[model samples]
Target: MKEKVGKQSLKFENAPYIIGAASVAGPKEIDGPMARYFDRVSEDPTFGKDSWEEGESEMVRQAVMLAIQKAGVNKDDIRYVFAGDLLGQLIASTFGIKDMEIPVFGLYGACSTCGEALSLAAMTVAAGYADNVVAEASSHYGSAEKQFRFPLEYGNQRPLSATWTVTGSGAFVVSDRESEVCIKGITTGRIVDYGVKDSLNMGACMAPAAADVIYQNLQDFDIEPTYYDRIITGDLGKVGKKILTDLLKMNQVDISDNHMDCGIEIFDNEEQDTHSGGSGCGCSATVLAGYILKKVSSGEWKRVLFVPTGALLSTVSFNEGQTIPGVAHAVVIEHHEMSKGK
Candidate 1:
């Protein structure tokens, strides 16, 4: 049986393994620092589709199929799929997996959808509900901008704190099978609002929630920040990175030495002009599938706390003058070699 740790965490009795993972990114992302790490990069922003939304769905399909292929498993063998995107009603994820005929649970956590999907997939497998499952998340710059902000044709100027939404998708196959990387535990976050109203500066809105979860994870596990080789956040750009570190320091839990932000890793801010950095569901998802997993599989990183953060505010909420509450979900990933150390 899984042990329910303090407040909002779970310690798995039979940790689930990430047997395979895949990342599919767009041209903009291909030009970024972690470009070579992606499984596939499409030169076409439309992904051969007529619309940006359709292109995003195609990216999701490519990622999910490739991950299954890498796992050497038949599509029929996949019991369920947990996926979502930064689109209304999860249309992107729906169209992407509709033809596969697998049972699916559409989720939404803004940029944190990847962590949320992965956590639920791990829990399902750990609880013996299925032999194998797929977890995926996606985001596209064009579609996100059209829905969340202004139209592409508008060409509105962005503030320095604004982050570029990543155009990419990442998928993973989780199973009880032995593998190099496994999920040991999870610490789910609660909605935290600091009365921040600026949607452009998402880092400020999400910093409090990220801090809350990190603090709780440390307390629940009875460990310090140094317990893991690294603590990675999803899309908290340059601004969020500073706020996150400072908030942790206030709690006497310092993680500055080993903290990494996917947003910061994906792009060269100065060169790319991606002011703060990258945001959206794909930012952390793609980095984890492409870069972080490689480090863990090769034993360069023994353990990691993967926390994807999100600023929860829709265009409707923003226009309606509602505060942007933030949420983050943390997953504890470990190398198979760590089993021997234990």
Candidate 2:
């Protein structure tokens, strides 16, 4: 039987299989460095929808449909759809997946929605609560900009510390049945607030939370930094990356050799004007679906620690001058070939 691994972690004896994953991104993302791996790219910013919010919904729906099709499972076969977005009340997830006719559990973890959704979906399958589930997340540049900052028409100067919001969606189908990619374990994060009030620099606000989770996972499992081929974080841009590395160094665990951030990997610094990098639910979700999983499937990476970080702030709270808190969740994915060798 599957059992709890350690503090804040769960061991999946069945190791819920990642049957398939799909990424759908906007035109700018489609032209980014990791563009080739995405399943679908929308050339239109609105994606033929009347509004940016509606466009985000389309991306989620398409991603879900594509992932299900790739998994070779009927929509009816999925027991539940676990999804979320940066938008208020998960509007994107609710309206986007409504047509699928599958039961859903809407989640909100800021940019870490992907990781949270994946962890819960894996746990549900591992615990025999479900046979298959779809975990998905999305974000849109225009909608997030208008909601969080000034509208696009304002053309407010984005400081170097500000990261661009990604316009994309990613969906993953996790099942109890065997597959090429499977989830081995998970480390759920805690809310950490360092009293940072600057809404522009999300990386700085979320780095501490990411570091804490990484350190906790390591200590709980009695593992070294070199245990995995890569220790990947969601969207903690360049600034957060340094903070996380410095924090880990204090803990006597160095991950610089293998640490990679999805935000840093997604865009070319010089070519793209994405200041620090990308941030949003889609930033890490799309990267995980389009890049990391593909790398693992090819046997290039044996095991990986995929952590997605999120800044817990809203327009109301930020406007009221509340500090931005952050959280992160970890998922350990291993390839079938690697599992066989073990």
Candidate 3:
């Protein structure tokens, strides 16, 4: 009956099923490999809005509404919405869902907001606090560049290490209703700093945190790396992917065989000319909603360790020459059949 597992983890006795999920992506993403999997795609980067920020809000709104509709649930039936975006004051999310009138919890874990939101949603539903809830995260490439790096108008040359921020939003309807996939457990991560101050190179900043959490999850569950069919990371791109595997290998926990990075999967580095890859909250969120869940639901991948990594840094902190610390949260997602016998 004990839900508390090991340090920094929880085993839910009543795992919440993901009744519905949706992904809304932008123009550039529409050309990517996973484009066909997205529920909604727009050729306009502004999403018919005047500004990039407003467009991002529209994406969030569309995603949440679509997810609710897919779940076949009335908006009033949902008890809470855990959502966020990579914007100051969470303006994107606030404006996006304010009119919905659902109780809301705005979260910010940089690009890892999706994982954080999902983890909290699972915990809340597992505790019998609510019958249904929505967890979503969004990020806009134009908005992110305006806030973090230089403006698109500046026409600055990005380094090869730089990653393109995804312009999209993903939402999930987590409820007590039985479904094809569910959240089994979670392993929360702590902020870890390697003192790397490169604002452009997020892979270097986040790989350490991803490695730490994945290692802890394996140890806490007393299982090997192969316990999950695939070990997924948020936005570690190519450079960070190498660093993550190398770090885990040092601990004798190798996930190289099944390791997959959302950043790497979202875009084709060569044709898209996206430099390293995609990096943003939407990167992992959309991938999970559009692609990963399908595989799990089809029983192609029975279980997956979804770890979304975040580089904790603001323009203010980066301008002050602060190191970009990283954090990652891991959610155990499995097929319903896998949990049936247990």
Candidate 4:
């Protein structure tokens, strides 16, 4: 039987390394002169869909194909595909992978699905149940706004904590090969709730979860903060990132210089007009697929930890006054021996 991480046990299987990864983004830049927030909508015609329903699945499909190609793996070699998105019922992921000719397992992790998918995919490959696995996440602004907040035509004022939805998709291919990036270790988070009532400020709601998992990952691995070249968090914006730093200090762990957050790093906060930071699956996905993967391939940084955090509340659940539940998963990526030699 495959070894599983028990609820309270820190024991875990070392993640099989990530061999390949890729990301894609919508053409319309929402931050430019044509920006209208909600009124303008996405005017980019490349989406090729009249509405959210058609475009989301297309983005997911494109991301998966790119990842598979980059990984140098054929579709027939992928044992299983694990994917998710912010859309209701994971419409983007389900429809996107339907024709990939590989068995698929659908997941729902709100905005944190990217890390969640990677964690599970690494586990599957590491445990030897499969030789190759594909994990991916995608999101679009139109569908997310319509489903989570309001209709496009509603034109409601957003709260200061409301995060700008990102338009992009990211995918990764994990395999047993020792030539590319290796998955080091993963730390899974428990549901945490501190009675924070505002869903708009998801950073506040999810920061604790990110901190908890980061602490546990270090504890579980018996590694020091300095051991990693960088420690990255998925989508905690400015406020949440601060909260996470403070929380880590409480545990005697300092990740100051080498730490970065995807939501904060993806776009320039001042230039992009992002009030706090970026959010959604695309936030981390794009960063990993675009920036981090290239760095790994180039041998700029050898070892890094990626923790994607998620707020597990939905529109209906939030409307019913349920407190937000949060979770995070950590994946370590490093250059392999063969790659480093080259």
For each candidate, the alpha-carbon lDDT, in order, equals 0.94, 0.92, 0.95, 0.77
Model 1 bad stretches (over 4 Å): 338-342
* lDDT, candidate 2, 1-342, per-residue tens: 446867888878778989989999998887689899888998997889999999999999999999999999999999999999999888989889998899889999999999999999999999899999999999999999988889899899988888989999999999987777889999999999999988999999999999989998888777997998999999999988999999899888899999999998888756889988888999999999999999888878989999999999999999898999999999988877644543
Candidate 3 lowest-lDDT run of ten: 333-342
Q: Write the per-residue lDDT of candidate 1 for residues 121-178, one digit (tens) a residue.
A: 9999999999999999999999999989999999999999999999999999999988
Which residue pairs collide in model 3, if any? none
Q: Which is the better candidate, 3 or 4, if ranked by TM-score?
A: 3
Inter-residue clash pairs, candidate 4: 17-182, 17-183
Clashes of each: 0, 0, 0, 2
Candidate 2: C-alpha lDDT: 0.92
**What is candidate 4's lDDT per residue for 119-228, written digit by digit as tens?**
88887888788998999987787788887888979887766666767777888888887655777666777778878878888898888998888887777677897778
Clashing pairs in 2: none
Clashing pairs in 1: none
What shift in Å separates residue 113 of candidate 2 from its native position after superposition? 0.4
Off by over 4 Å in 2: 338-342
TM-score for all models, in order of appearance: 0.98, 0.97, 0.98, 0.90
Model 4: ten consecutive residues of lowest lDDT: 33-42
Error of 2 at 313 (Å): 0.3
